[model samples]
Target: MGDILAHESELLGLVKEKDLVAAFDNGDQKVFFDLWEEHISSSIRDGDSFAQKLEFYLHIHFAIYLLKYSVGRPDKEELDEKISYFKTYLETKGAALSQTTEFLPFYALPFVPNPMVHPSFKELFQDSWTPELKLKLIKFLALISKASNTPKLLTIYKENGQSNKEILQQLHQQLVEAERRSVTYLKRYNKIQADYHNLIGVTAELVDSLEATVSGKMITPEYLQSVCVRLFSNQMRQSLAHSVDFTRPGTASTMLRASLAPVKLKDVPLLPSLDYEKLKKDLILGSDRLKAFLLQALRWRLTTSHPGEQRETVLQAYISNDLLDCYSHNQRSVLQLLHSTSDVVRQYMARLINAFASLAEGRLYLAQNTKVLQMLEGRLKEEDKDIITRENVLGALQKFSLRRPLQTAMIQDGLIFWLVDVLKDPDCLSDYTLEYSVALLMNLCLRSTGKNMCAKVAGLVLKVLSDLLGHENHEIQPYVNGALYSILSVPSIREEARAMVP
Candidate 1:
């Protein structure tokens, strides 16, 4: 404690009022040097004691005033040396003070000696420093820079400040360049955004037109050709498929056929018949155009269309193929779809089966395919009794029975039993189903082989046909009579039918 007091008294002696006033009055900074050499130099070098540290900072405050006033105009080298000494003192001891109340006051002062004295301040603009430290150092340098530009310190900078000015100017130019680049990039981004919106609008317009054209409104082959041409490319096709809503029933298939269908040449008196081969070649490169477009459109509809209508539209269009061979190629997939848990798929399967039965080749194909025959029989045997499926099965059976080979297959597979069972379930069968079943039965009994098959189940057949005689569906009575008359034609089956009469 005594040593600290002695140090404090000695520091006070160095800055005594008479000596400081005389030094200023005489315009002599030698007194500032005398104060530094006498008491401050050693204290700045080894100022670990609190009193010595306080005296050292007091010396720095006096140097700041001396530099501010230029009272004696210290030599530039001498001023730099003094500032360098003050910088080392502050750096070595500033950290402890930074956490105390004294830091803000010291930081707020405009006179910061020279930023070039501290290494951190010297690299203030370098990115290697932490952002927090760089920010603090930048503020410190800025305050010093502002003070250095003042009338008292302007010459100090004019003599040796070229590097600092250049660093600041370079930073300003870089900021300006960065702002210009940002503006340019922003313009490009905005243009791209605008173009994207315009493209979206154009796509939406095309989708609207496509939907309207597909709905059978203003549908001409040429308009469809134009639309397909517009959507011919894969990218355009994908976009059109995704953007257009085809929820309206049958629209997708209708559009597909409309797009790919050949233009029919109107017959004229003088003109030669239009060469279909050349015309078709010109219309589409491959016959697979229909297949490809149909597959693509059906896949799209599978995702977009309502559950019930999807298979119906696809199957209906599939049935419209000109070549039975072409339809047969896709029959496996259709048969697989028949087994779907969706009632919608099963219903459409029945419609497709009815359509196939209406074609001679399709009926022969179905009758020959035991898998198809079994599927039909299974559908017919369903206890829940779907009327449309049963009706279609009967229609298919009637077609098959017309061909002797198919009739034999039916008997061998015991599918003829399904017809008799349907006939027996008059309470369950629809009027259309009853008519179809009786018609199938009439066809099945026409031949001796089929007669033997029915004779095996003659009691049940006779009973069901006899019950149908008084059916309120008069449409069924004629078919029932025809079936019974055919059954009674075979002598042995006829005797058995008579025995079944109530």
Candidate 2:
């Protein structure tokens, strides 16, 4: 106890000193680890009530600090060693506390996983002292079980006398309860309902429970088939479509994104051995439903005027793809939706175009069916002759070029002619508009077809640059200059610049 007090005093003195926290900031992992080790070790040994609480608090604080700093290239060996030591320390202290009813709360504290990695520590500990700890422990173990590939922990649990049937039963019961509670809680927090695995587990339990309650004659495979058919039928599609516009920015879209936020692929649950084949078959057969959901989700990406909504929509689209096969024929329905609503889908189309340059080139090609491009061409307005919203327009143009550079060359020629006409408009030549227009033109000029297309756009670029040279917005000036520099860097545009100088 005296040694523990001495260490606490030392920690306090260290905290009081100038720049103690700066040791963490300076990227000195060893010092940060040592500070945490000493504090945690002392607290564990002393077992002072206040010190025990402080120990848990500091463990979390230091763990988060270390994780945040050590994100790229963490010291894995050192981290494992520290975790082993910490776990050993906790076990010793927990064993001591288990001997006394008064120390049961500390048992709860020890079980709370570090919150930085697992944010549900508080909830996990909610019934820790109740008779339901075994159930809660089972849920906790199951959650981690899905994440753990190694069988060491499971083997240990089995050796300790936990039966497979008990484990499975506990999991099944916890999921059943979680589903019931989630429905009630979702009225206030919709995100809990949107989580894919949570929904899957709950739905599976509902099906199982329903099956068990029915008479043996009524529980035939054909009956089960009819039930699934009804559940995923077109009526449900209409119901889902009307319940919330997954396309319009709303609570549902937000909740869906929160639920499907990426987890490490390995951490996601492996398909159960029995259901793996059925899962694949269901995914293949249910492609149409997946397509509808994606299209509606894409619409939310389009109609959402807010930047936050736009970002979330992009992320959700990525997540939705994880469940559906990328090359599935049902993707055509999504493209058809995009084609049918070209004007309303402009923002999402533009985003898709930009994304293609990075991650979705094949999807962009598949999506830009001739019908979609024709719709885009039809939507071209006289005002677009000047490249207002040119960044977005150019992104779309770039994708079209990628899809069909030869066929798009003529369209490019026509667009450039309009760009020159718009650039020559005194009223259309403002700093903001010209900056975006010139950048778009520069992007176009960089394209292979746009090489031959550059000569015609050069006069407009030179005129825009000359006007922009005296603009007052310092930010706009650099961008305009950069665009001009890019255009001049091209051989044809360089000749145009020289021709004008002479």
Candidate 3:
């Protein structure tokens, strides 16, 4: 035992020597693996105190090597053999597993490695039983499970015509025990709850992969939709309670959206009707909590790359129901998010407005909502007063007006009112606010009754444009010119334009 310990220490010393790492960097995989294998075997046999640390170090080094050179290489058999040896070493040195509780590298490396070109080495640690190791293994499995290309083991299942539901059920059962254990691990290791959050992210990824892979298969749409709703709701709840910066909270929203993209609407059976009135009542009662969740969900949806999915979800939840319900139930929530200090929320609001404009129409449901229209009108009013939010709000309104011309008469009326009010204040006409206001009015005029309304407000329009035309700002002149063209093209306003020019 003494001789074995001494030999192990010598091997550890050699492994850490800068020259050994350099040799591996120089394409000396054979030499590096030989020394690594000898040291790992000896360490396991001798029960060296630093065996786990050495194993972790080797894993890190091997990962770095694979990333730098092994990507797309055909000769991975040696790499596989080396990983197999390490797995055996770990099993042999089962007593050393408890020595190390941190596997940060394992959790992150899967994301860093090009999984498409280079397979992960996770299978090497499959038999791991420690809470820390199991957590890392779960993440590794999730990364592998998400691969669209069939895995070797899955090929047999595919050939056998085994349904995705069966595969998922099997995987779910496998993960159920792990999930329970992870909760236990969280309680036992509170200091590392953040690490458990990493597990949560992986769990989300697994759910996403299951949804993607099983689409159109025996996996019932109802089941998948239920899973998605639960997952989204869980994430929403957790994010609300915690200060999760979804910008990089490291959750799986992005991945889930990608995976679920192929999902057809039919698969997600129409959501059962909720007594929206009851739901609204409950939301109003729980306004504070609901607002928090809304803000978080908005941030997640807006800041992330999946704004379309986020936008869809919000539409279903807020817009599809009666406009009044949306306004009364979610007005405060939307306002809270819009006014939030977070740039994520602001950008999201911009996207939401744009989407709403594209989809707006004089549907019976939308037209009946006087309160919702008023709220939208109010947003435009407030935006006109504030320079910072003016452009985005105007842009949104312009889109909305174009899409729903009939419903926009009220908005057009408001625009005419604002234009008249702004022209009365000469100082306001000279300011940059006048540019956005004019452009917004131009868009309104392009709508059904907009041309007629422009004629009514012709005097105010010509006054603003005349003042803008004289200004030295070159940029303001073009926008003012465009607004003039839109207004004068209307026959009713042509006489008014000629009078102003003459």
The most accurate candidate by TM-score is 3
- lDDT tens digits, residue span 338-443, model 3: 4444454444454454444544432333444455345455655665334445455555555554546433765545666675576555464445456556556666
True-structure RMSD, every candidate: 34.6, 27.0, 26.2
lDDT of 2 at 69: 53
For each candidate in the order shown, give its overall lDDT on alpha carbons. Answer: 0.54, 0.45, 0.49
lDDT of 2 by residue, 436-498 (tens): 454445455555565556566677767766765665544345445545655566787888788
TM-score of each predicted structure versus truth? 0.35, 0.30, 0.36
> Who is ahead in TM-score, 1 or 3?
3
Question: After superposition, which runs of candidate 3 have C-alpha atoms over 4 Å from their true positions?
Answer: 1-130, 133-293, 302-324, 327-355, 358-368, 382-392, 406-408, 423-436, 447-449, 470-479, 489-493
Deviation from truth (RMSD, Å), model 3: 26.2
Evaluated against the true structure, the overall lDDT of model 3 is 0.49
User: What lDDT does model 1 reach?
Assistant: 0.54
C-alpha positional error of residue 231 in candidate 1 after TM-score superposition, expressed in Å: 55
